[model samples]
Target chain A: EPEVTQTPSHQVTQMGQEVILRCVPISNHLYFYWYRQILGQKVEFLVSFYNNEISEKSEIFDDQFSVERPDGSNFTLKIRSTKLEDSAMYFCASRGPTEIHYEQYFGPGTRLTVT
Target chain B: SQQGEEDPQALSIQEGENATMNCSYKTSINNLQWYRQNSGRGLVHLILIRSNEREKHSGRLRVTLDTSKKSSSLLITASRAADTASYFCATYVMGFQKLVFGTGTRLLVSP
Candidate 1:
């Protein structure tokens, strides 16, 4: 089965530094999303993308956060200034272009450690 | 927060035992989905039950959704050690446009 893939399984960055998490969603998927999970916490939605634009976002997705589909295959989340609270497991997910009804396939996730 | 809440935050059972997890939510949803996550890993989709469906099953996993009650349950029968993972219930918001996941139930199936 085709699955979403993310790069840099682990990321360590200094506080206030910029970080961009990359994801390659399933080739035919039309909806892409980014979510985060704090250690021992439930997953939180960050943003959703379709047609090269963000469809909806949460308060957690502030000015410091931006998403881009630089290419047809790559969806990336960029944090302009990282903070200690920003450290979490960031997961990329994709859905659609299948017969299954409304299921998002998640990637292995990138563990972001902000020090 | 429109997040779902799961009960029995942690459970431990021996192999061949049945494990059941329950979830409740506070909002109207289009569907409910269950996912599993190994320690520090990503989520694995388990099964989904639409708001219109009362129950659905896949393999040893069974999911039930009560739209009127705004609750769902996941049951794993004759589970194995490999089934030990954190199970989460996610609700679809805005007609499948977004998902709100709940605090998961961590199950440990001992061999």
Candidate 2:
């Protein structure tokens, strides 16, 4: 079964530093998303991307965050300046044909730790 | 601020026993999905039940949706030790692609 893949399984950065998380969604998927899970907490939606534009974003996805599909296969989330509270596990997900009730496939996730 | 919330923060059972988790949402949804995540890993899609559908099944997993009550339940029968994981319920609100996830139920199955 094809699955979403993300790079940099774990990252540690200092406060005020920048970090880029990359994901390669399933080849045929049309919709992509980014979510974060603060240690032992519920998963929180950050942003959704479709057709090279942001479809919707949660309040957690503020000015510090931005997502881009720079190529047909690569989708990335960039954090301008990391903060201690920003430490969490970031997951990338994708789904095919938004009209149908298809399940979203999630990647293994990148553990972001800010000091 | 959480749209979906699950009950019984944690559960434990024997290998052959059954496990059930419940989720409640605050608003109307297009569809509800259940996912499982092993320790420190990504989520795996388990099942999806639309608002119009009352019940759905896949192998040993059964999912029931009660849109009128804004609640849903997931049942896993004859579970194995490997089935131990955190289960989450996510709701896709109407007119959008975002999915709001609930606090997960942590299941620990002993062999």
Candidate 3:
């Protein structure tokens, strides 16, 4: 089955450096999302992208965070200045055209470590 | 906060036994979904029960949703050692377009 894939399975960055997490959602998917899991905690939604614009975002997704679909298959999340709290597993997910059922496919996730 | 809570922070069962996890949500939702995550890995979609539907089954997995009570349960029967993982319930809201995940139930099926 086709699945969402993310690049840089693991990353280590300085506290004030920039990091870009990349994902390639399923080719036909229209809705894309970014979420983070802090260590063993529950997953938290960051932002959702559809129709080339942000549909919704959480308070956790502040000015430091931005998402871009620079190409047809590539969706990227960039953090301007990483904080210690930014060390977490960042996941990328995608869903098909239907909006009601809301079934999503998640990628393996990129583990971001800020020091 | 994405509105769902799960209990039994951890559970242990032997292979061939059954495992059940429960989830409770605070508000109305379009559907409730169950997902599994291995240690330090991404999530895998398991099952979805719509607010209008009462129960659903896939393989040895069964899910029931009680919209009126705002709770749901997932049962895994005749489980295997490989079933050891953290199970999460996510609540889906309409126009907000988000899936808020619960704390999750960690199941350890020993061989």
Candidate 4:
């Protein structure tokens, strides 16, 4: 089974620095999403993308956050200026056509630690 | 602030025992999904139940959705140590493209 892949499984950056989390969704999947989970908290949706554009976003996805499909295979989430609260497990997910119904496959996730 | 909330934040059971977790949501939804996450690992999709569906099953896992009450439950039968993980219930609210996940239930299946 093809899985979503993310780079830099663990990232450590200084506060106020810019960081981009990269993901390579399944080749054929059309819908891509980014979600984050604070330690011991529920996973929160950040943004959803389709056709290389944002379909929807949450309040957490403020001006500091941006997503890009720079290439056919790469979907990235960029934080213009990091904060301590930005430290969390960021996950990338993709969905493709399925016979039963649609389902999003999640990647292993990138643990972002901002200090 | 709109999100699903799971009950019994944590559970512990022995191998071969059955584990049950419950979830409740505040809004109408198109579908409900369950996911599992191991410690320090990413989430794994377990199952999804549409709003119109009452129940669904996969392997040892069973999920039931009651739209009237806006609640769902996940049951894991004949559990094993490997089944120990954090289980989350996510709801896809109507007219939205993103999912809102609950706080999750951490289960520890002891060998």
Docking quality tier of candidate 2?
Answer: high
* Off by more than 4 A, model 1: A98-100
- Looking at candidate 1 chain B, the ten consecutive residues that score lowest on lDDT are B91-100
TM-score between predicted and true chain B, model 1: 0.95
The TM-score, computed over Cα atoms with residue i paired to residue i, of candidate 2 is: 0.98
lDDT of 3 by residue, A54-109 (tens): 99999999999999999999999999999999999999999986665388999999
Predicted complex 2: DockQ: 0.95
Model 4 over residues A1-115: C-alpha lDDT tens digits? 7999998899999999999999999998889999999998889999999887999999999999999999999999999999999999999999875423457799999999999
For each candidate in turn, the TM-score is: 0.97, 0.98, 0.98, 0.97
Computed on C-alpha atoms, the DockQ of candidate 3 is 0.94
Looking at candidate 1 chain A, the ten consecutive residues that score lowest on lDDT are A95-104
For every model in order, what is the number of clashing pairs? 0, 0, 0, 0
True contacts kept of 3: 0.97
Stronger candidate by TM-score (3 vs 4): 3
lDDT of 2 at B64: 98
DockQ of each candidate relative to the true complex: 0.79, 0.95, 0.94, 0.91
Query: What value of lDDT does candidate 4 attain over all alpha carbons?
Result: 0.93
Pitting candidate 1 against candidate 2, the one with the higher lDDT is 2
After superposing candidate 4, which stretches have Cα over 4 Å from the reference?
A98-101
Candidate 2 TM-score on chain B: 0.97
Tens digits of per-residue lDDT, candidate 2, B24-108, equal: 9988899999999999999999999999999999999999999989999999999999999999999999888888899989999
Q: What range of 10 consecutive residues in model 3 chain A has the weakest lDDT sum? A: A96-105
Candidate 1 CAPRI grade: medium
